[model samples]
Structures are given as structure tokens and as C-alpha cells.
Target: MSSGRIQQALLAWYGDNARDLPWRRSRDPYRVWLSEVMLQQTRVETVLPYYERWLERLPTVAALAAADEETVLRLWQGLGYYRRARNLHRAARAIVEERGGRWPASAAEWRQLPGVGRYTAGAIASITRGEPAAVVDGNVKRVLARLFLIDEPVDDAATLRRLWLLAESLVPAAAPGDFNQALMELGARICRPRRPRCDLCPLRPDCRGRRAGVAESLPRRRRRRPIPHRQEVAALVVRGGRYLLGRRPPGLLGGLWEFPGGPVAEGESPPQALARALVERLGIEVDVGPRLAAVDHAYSHLKVTVALYRCRLTGGELRPAYHTAARWLRRRQLGDLPLPRVTRKLARHLAA
Candidate 1:
């Protein structure tokens, strides 16, 4: 079957089965851009409430550009990948200042923005600007890999390049956005990683993987390296009904507030690590007390276990050494500040 016929079948299926997501209801570029950014490495169910709440708070590109960094980060608290929020904020400002309040008219132009990569740019352009651009996200990759029966590792650069070429060829000129979205929707709903619903797939007739009896196994991926684990300690310093929190320096979870702490050295106990961290980081001596709680969290490359310890300030003046800033915040006020997921969990444990 020709690409055109496949497109027709897919589009027809899509018109009947596409999920009515909030972003799909409008062609507004800002909303589409926001959704694209949020949807990266995140699930629809997880993003729904965050999307609704984000739009409510920052209704427009202008609003997002004008909002303070802390405010934006606070709104994006649980969305992991803090860099995405920062880049989105920067891109909004650039769109307003450099483009005179108008979104870029083409995918190429959108790619020049801070966080807009090829896939994101293509999605925004095709979906909102009626541009015939190809978007190959994870869903589309799975769908295409199975459709063509490509067995190369999907993460390989050459394999991905070939996939992109095929995607570009298959995207219909008319209603390109709908066509691209249809491909993604099909993958998300029918061409899923496990137990794909090949019977319900419109492209099943032409699917090479299905005919070859390997639809579920095409697009093989390389094994990931074992994630390294580390143990860390945090000092829960309470003074005058307020808990002390320190701002992380500019990097990974940058600018987020958390309890003062650092990784435990080899053979160092949690309490000793906390006590030493206080002396070196805050220039204060603390008598580390009983362990409060232990929280386990994982990042893309690292797994960490954080042990929270109640502490008393034994002596010395408080001074910020490693942190950008340090503050004593009430439990209620902690909600307004940006916090990493593990820190938030620690806060809840303390509150309970």
C-alpha cells in the first residue's frame, strides 16, 4: 500500500478514535507548545492536572514570560526535570521580546528557541501553524518501527535518522497536523509496547512486523547501565517554629529549596555526615539527633536514599557557603517554594 492510502486509513481511524485531550481542542500555539514540553518523558494521566493548573496560572506566553522564576518553579514542583521548566520560561521570554509577541511561523524558527528541539518544533508547527512537518516522538517511533519491521536499536543515530526520513515521507501535506497526531494516537492507544492491539490498528494490514510475527519486538533497544546508588543525609533544623531550608546552587535541581545536607562519605554515618555538612556548609555546629525518616528517589542517572535527621544548633553563626541562600520557613510556607520530590516527601513525613 502507498503512503497516501496508509495516511487515509489512519486519519479515518483517528477522526473516530482520537482522545479529546485539552491541548487537542485548540490550535493555540502557546497551549500546544506547553503541552508538548510537558508531555516529554511524562504520561497523559500524570500531565492532565498539571496542564490544567499550569494554564490556569500562566494563561499566555506573556504571563509565563512575566512570572518570576520561583513562581514558575513552584507551579512546576512535582514535574521532575527542572530544566524543562527553566527552558520553557526562557523560551517564553524570548518569544515575547525577540519575536514581538508572535510565535515563530515555522518549525525551523521554533527550533531556535531555548527548549524547542526538532520534534517539539515540528509538533508545534504542524499542529498549530498548518505546516507540513514530521514529528517522531517515542509513540511515533514505535508505530513506524513496527509498521516497517525495522529491527535496529531505536536509539541508534542512523536508525533514528532513517525513521525520521520515513516519517517525513508519510506525513500528508493537507491536514498534516491531524495526520501526525493520528500516528501518535495510534501508537499510544493501539501500537503500545506490550500486548499491542493489532486487530484494532488501521495500519495492521500493511504492518510488516505483524506479518513477520514480531510486531511487539521490533525497535529493539540497548540495555541500560545499572543506576548507581548513594546515601545522603539532611538536617531538619527547626528554630522558632520555622524549618531551615537551603537553596540549591545553579545545577541539577537548581534554585529549589531543601533541607541542608550532602552525600555521606565512605563509612560516615548519617548523623556524622549531617553534623559535618552543617559545619562546612552553614558554618554552624549542630548536634545531630535521631533519624526522622528515609526517602528513596531516582533521577535519570542516579538513585539516592535521603535520611532526614532532627538536629539542634549547638553553636556558631549561620552563614551560607554552598547554597545560594538559606532561610527558615514555616511548614505552610514551604508549599509556596519550589522543592524537589524527595524534599517534598521529607516535608510530608515531618508534618505527619
Candidate 2:
């Protein structure tokens, strides 16, 4: 079968077996946009609950546009890669103010929206508008690389460009949304990253890699270098019953709450790092004690091993330098506060 026949077979298979994801219930641009943002670097199972809650809170783009940053951040508490939340908020506001509260229709127009990259624009445009744009996310990348026997790693810009061209060529006409979703579904379920279900795939007969018995090796990845590691000391400052938590400022994991902490310099003890960080961020003297809970958080770029300390706030009022504001809340009130999962995981130990 030709590549076009392969796509047609896959599309037919998808029409019968495509997952009934919550995001597919409606073609509303806002709902689809929200799911796409939340689903980036996140699993569908995890994004589902968050998506439902987010929609319940800010059902409309204008509502999200009008909501306070704190409320938005709180709603986005456990979802990491927080720039997605900020970008969504910024995009919502942009649509409200500039586009008269309606999202743009074309991929070119959607690309101008905050945080909407080419892939995201393509996803939104194709899903919502039936545009002939294909999205080459990780799943689709695996599917394409394995299907066409491409040896280039997905992360290489040149390889990715070629993959996109191939994707554009294969995307079926008239139902780009279904086709893109089917490709992604195939990748997520049958064409998995670790183990593919070639026996069950409709395109198995036509797959070049499968014919060569190299399906697993076609999308060869460069050997992964160990993720760079950094250590940090966090001061878990508590006053009365409440503990001090800072709202991370906009940029990366912006808007999420975190314990006061930063990079631990060379030869610096955890206590020393804790004290220096408190002074720099809050202008307060804190007595760092024994370790409370240590967590290793992995980001796309690097990894951080954080050692948290229970600190006594000796002096100085709140003068948050790198955060929007600081707050102290009871252990139970912590539930109401949206916090980083790593920080929230630490809270149980701190509350002990």
C-alpha cells in the first residue's frame, strides 16, 4: 500500500476505535485549546480531571480572561510546566481584547496567540477548523518515524522539519482533526514509545520498518546524556499555624506556589543556602534546622534535588523579591492553596 493508503487505513481504523476522550466531546475552540495546553507534556488521564475542573472554573475564554492571576494559578496548581497556564491566560485575554472574545480561525492567526507554537497552532486549527495541518507531537513522531523508517531522532530540528513535511503529505483531506487525532491515538496506544502493537495495527502490512523487521530501530535516538543536576535548600517558614509559601513569578513555572529556595552554591551547606536564600528573597533571618523532606524534581532542561528545612522566622516583614506575594496558612488551609506537586508532597512531611 502507498503512504496515502496507509493513512486511509489508519483513519478507518481510527473512526472505529478512536478513543472517546473528553476533549473530543465538543469542537469548541476554547475547550480544545485548553485541553491541548494541559495535555502538553502531560498524560491524558492526568489532564482529564484537571481539564474538567478548569472548565468548571473558567468555562469561557472571557471568564478566564477576567479572572485574577491568583485564582488562575490556584486552578492550575498541580499541573507543572506552568508557563502553559500563563500563556493560556495571556492568550485568553488577547482573544477577549483584540479578537473580540473569539479565537482566530486560521493556523497563522492562532500562531500569534501567546504560547501557541507551530504544533499547537496546527493542532488547534486542524481540530477546530478542519484545516489540513498535521501535528507532529511525540506520539505522531514515533508513528511517522516507524512507518516511513526515518532514522533521524525526533528532537533534531532538521529531522523534525522533514517529519512535518511528511506529516503534511499524509494528513487526509476534509477530516484533518480526526486524522491527526487518529495518528496520535495510534501512537499513544498501538504505536507506543516503548513497545508497539504492530500485530494489531492496520498499517502493519504497509509499514516499511515492519517489512524490514526494524520497526523498533527506525526512530533511533541519540544516547541520552545524564540530566544536569543541582542541589537546593528550602526554608519551610511557618508562622503560627500557617507556613510561608511564595507565588512563583511569570516566566517558567510561573504562578505556582513554592517553598523559599534557590540554587545551592558550591561548598555551601544546606543551612547556609537556606539562610542566604531567605535573606535575599524575604529579608528575614531564619534558623534552618534538620531536613524535613527531600525531593528530586525533574524538568525538561535539568533536575533539582531539594532539601527542605523547617525554619524559625526570626525577624523582618514580608518583602518578596522574586514572587508576587507571600502567605502563611494552616496545614489544612494548604489544601485550598494551589502548590507545586513537589512542594505539596513535602507538605505532608512538614505537617507531621
Candidate 3:
């Protein structure tokens, strides 16, 4: 199949069918960069409000650079995996300091900026500078592998590297940004992960997967190892009607409240782990009780089997080195706290 013909088809398809996302409003590098960063591991619907609110709060590189971390974090609260926000803040400072507060104009120069990965650099360069750089993100990988019927499992490292080369090869010099966006849009909207609408695909006729009658089967994936189950005992330490909560340490779900818990080490029981965690973290020794309930909470990278315990503190002092703050809040007020989903799950189980 001719690359030019495929490009024409994709471009036409994009014009008619692309999602009307706010960030696609223009080729502004800063807005594009911000949207790309915010969208990582987040759904488009989820990112929309955060992006709008964030842009309204910090309209320029200088604004973000000058903003304090706490305000930044507060704005980014509930977004999850807050390191992206922090890195965005850090990179903004560097741009304002070294690059005269403008987004670096070249892909190589953009790559030099903090938090900017290869795919992000490709997006920034293509969108802003019209550079012929291809972005081999998940969407692109799915689209290309099916279009060409590439049999390499997309999850394999070598196969992914091969896909990158193929992505670059197929990226036409003319309107690289639109081309890249078109492929991504097609994959997202039409060549979906499951139950794809192949009949609606512009590349349907040219798609090798379709030609070979394997449209649903191509772009094979290496089976992902099931997320390991981690067992932990959470202290639902109740003094009167109030429960103990600790702020998660900075970096990765930072600043959120959690009923303290960690993995149940080999051969150690949940009650024992809870007892140890309380003393180690808060200088408190507690009497472990029967399990209040167990919860299965799943996050992006792992699944946790959490055992909740009703316990009383026998003796100890509140320590704050590992936590930003520790507090005993009434059960009703626990809902007001910005706790992790797992912590809220614990409360729900306890209430039931």
C-alpha cells in the first residue's frame, strides 16, 4: 500500500471524525505539552477538568514557575500520581530560567527539558514546529501493528522498538502533526482495543489485519503478568468515635490520608504487621483485634488485599517524621479528608 494514499485517507478521516478535545484547539506548544503530561495514564474525560482548571490557574510558564508547590499540589489533588505535577512544575521553572520562558523549539531541545519523554518530544515538535517526528504511543502502536499486520507482540521490548522505527518511517513530512493525530484518533475511536468498528475505519481496506480477516486478532500482545497480590493489615485505630489517619509521604500518592498499612511480610500475619506498623510509624503500641473486614483495592500498578482491624492504642506518642500530619478525626469527618480510595473503601467496609 502507498504511504501517500494511507496518509490521505487518515487525514480525511481525522477531519471528519476526530474528537473535539479542548487541547486540540491549536498548535500551541505549552498547551500541547501540558495536555500530554496530564493525559498520561489518565482518561481524556478525567483530564479535561483538571487541564482546564490548571490552565486557568497557571496560564503561562512564568506563572507555574512562580507558583508554590503546595498550591500546585492542591490544584493537582485527586489527579493521582502527583509526581507528574511536580515534574511539570520543575520543568516550567527550568524553561523560565534557561530558555527565556518559551517552550524549547526543537525536538532535541525539548527532550532536554525535564519530564519530557521521547513520545512527548515528538508530539511537541510535530505540533508546534511541524517537524516530521512520529509519536509511537499506545494508540499509534495499536493502529500501526494492525494496519501492517506486524505479528510482534507489542509488549515485547524489541517489538516496541521496531514499532518506533516503523512509526518514524511512516510519518510523512507534510503535516506530521495532523498525520500523527489522525492515526491516534483512528485507533482511539475506530480501531479500538476490543470490539473495533473495522467497517467504519478509513484504513479498513488497507489494514492488513482486515485483509487477512484478523482485524480483531492482529497487533498481538504479550500476556501481562497478573498484578501481584499484596497483603497488608490496616489499622482502623479507633479512640472513642474517631479514627487515626496518616498523610502519605511525598512522591506517589503523596499528601493523601491513608489508614496506615504496608505489605504483610513473608510468614507474618496481618495482625502482626499492623501492630508493627503502628509502633514503627507512630510510636504507638496497639492491641490488634479481629479483622473488621478485608478489601481488594486495585491501582494502576498493583492490587492490594487489605485487612482492616479494629484496635485500641495501649501506649505511645504521635510521631510525625514519616508523615506530614497524623490526626484522629470523627468517623463522619473521615469522609471530608482526602484519603486514598483504599482508605475510603476501608471506611465503607467498616460502616457496613
Candidate 4:
């Protein structure tokens, strides 16, 4: 099939059916970049509120750059994959300080920013700058896989490279941004992962997968290993109506506040593990009491069930061995600090 014909059909469909997203109304690089980052591994409905809240608080790149880390993390409290928010802050600072607040002009230059990969760079460049760059996001990949009936796993590096090349070849010089968005929109709305609405798809006639009666299963992936489950514990050490919270050191869930504790070892009971973890992680002794809450949370790579137990700080110096800082705050005051979902669940249990 000719690239021109396919592009024409997709663009026409997009013009009629594109969702009225906030970012689509403007060609501003900052807005485009922010939307692309937030939309990664997140659905549009889920990102809508967060995206609006972010702009309302930190409207400009310069504003975000000037904001403190705590404020940024606080704004991004419930949005997981906090690394994206941190990288956005870093990239904003770099753009303001190093580039004199000028946005990158081309996809190549945009790739230099922190947290920006090929897909993001291509999106921002093509959408805002009218550059003929191609984006191969999950949506685009699905569309492409079905359009050409690609049998290979989309996650493979070799397959990804081929998809990129195919995208590059098809992206039209005229309104490349609309073309890219149209292709992605097609996958999202019509060529869905399951039970696609092929009857309404503009590319229905040309879709090789549909012709071969396998459109829904064209974008196959390799079998993934089972997600490991972990058991952990947290100490709710309360004194004078105040609870102890620890600021995590730089790493996974870094800079976020949590009830002090760690993973439960294989042979250790929950209370014993909590006591040992407090001594090892916080350099303080706690008399583990009755359980307060059990938080079952799942991250991308692992699932964890954290048992929260009431504890009394018994002895030892109040030194932060693993945390950057430790503070005591009332249950109500917990709202002031950024917390992971698991920590928030524990706090809610306390409040209840």
C-alpha cells in the first residue's frame, strides 16, 4: 500500500475523531513535552487531572525549574514513576540555565533533555515545530503491527528499530504532527488491543492483519516472567499524638516520606522484622505492637503487602541510617509531606 494513501486516511479520521485534549489545542513545546511524559505508561483519563493540576501550579518551564524538590514531589504524590517528575524538573532547569529558556528546535536536540527518549523527542518536535519526525509509542506500534500484520514481538529491539524506520518513511512532510497523532489515535480508539472496531477504522481495507483475520492479535509480545510478591512491614511509632515518618534516601521512591520499616526476612515474624528493620534502617529501637493496617500495593515490577504495626520507640539514638531525614508529625500533618500510596494507606488507617 502507498504511504500517501494510508496517511491521508488516518489524518482524515483524526481530524474528525481526535479527543479534545488540553495539550492538543496549543503548539507550545513545554505543554507538548509535559503531556508526552505524563502520558507515558498512563492512560489519558488518568493523566487529565494531574496534567491540569501541574499546569495550574507550575505553568512555565522557568517556574518548574525554580520550584523546590519537595514541592514538585508533593504535586506528583500519587502519580507513580516519580523519576519522570524529577527528570522533568531537571530538564526544565537545564533548559532555563543552559539554553537560556529556548526550547530545542529539532528532534535530535530534544533527545538531549533528561528523561526524553526517541518517542518523546519525536512527538515534541513534530507536534510543535512541524518537523517530519516519527514517534513509535505503544499506540503507534499497535497500529503499525496490525496494519502490516507484523508477527514478531514488538518489544524486541530489532522489531522496534524496524517500526521506527517504517514510521519515519510514512510520516508526511505536511502536518507531520497531525499525522503522528492520527496514527496513535487510530490505535487508541479503533485498532484497540482487544475487540477492535475494525468496521469503523479508516485503514480497515488496507489492514493486512484484518485481511488475514488476526488484527486483534497482530502485536504479539514474548511471555513475561511472573511478577514477584514481597512481604514488608512498617512501624507506626506514635508519641504525644505524633507519628514518626522518614524521608527515603535517593533511590526507588526517593524523597518521599514513609513510616519507618523494611522488608520482612524469611524466618522473621512481622513484629520481629519491624523491630530489626527499625534498628537497622533508622538506628532506633521500637517495641512492635498490634497491627494497624495491611497495605497491598503493586508497582510495575513487583507486588508488595506491607503490614503496618503500632510501635513504641523504646531506645537507641534517633539517627537516620537509611533515610535522609526523620521527623515526627501528627496524623493530620501527614498531608504536608509527599507519601507513597502504601504510606498514604497506613496514614488513612490511623486516621480512621
Best prediction by TM-score: 4
How does model 2 score by TM-score? 0.94
- Give me the runs in candidate 2 sitting further than 4 Å from their true place: none
What's each prediction's TM-score? Answer: 0.96, 0.94, 0.87, 0.97
Q: TM-score of predicted model 3?
A: 0.87
lDDT tens digits, residues 56-173, model 1? 9999999999999998898888887888999999999998998889889899999999888999999999999889999999998999999999999989999999999999999988
lDDT (Cα) of model 4: 0.92
Q: Each model's C-alpha lDDT?
A: 0.92, 0.84, 0.84, 0.92
Better of 1 and 2 by TM-score: 1
lDDT of 3 by residue, 176-274 (tens): 999988988888889998889998988887888878877777678888778887888888888887888888787647777788766789999788888
Off by over 4 Å in 3: 68-79, 97-100, 238-243, 250-252, 289-293, 321-338, 349-352
Superposed model 1: Cα runs more than 4 Å off: none
lDDT of 4 at 21: 99
Every candidate's CA RMSD: 1.5, 1.8, 2.9, 1.1
Ranking by TM-score: 4, 1, 2, 3
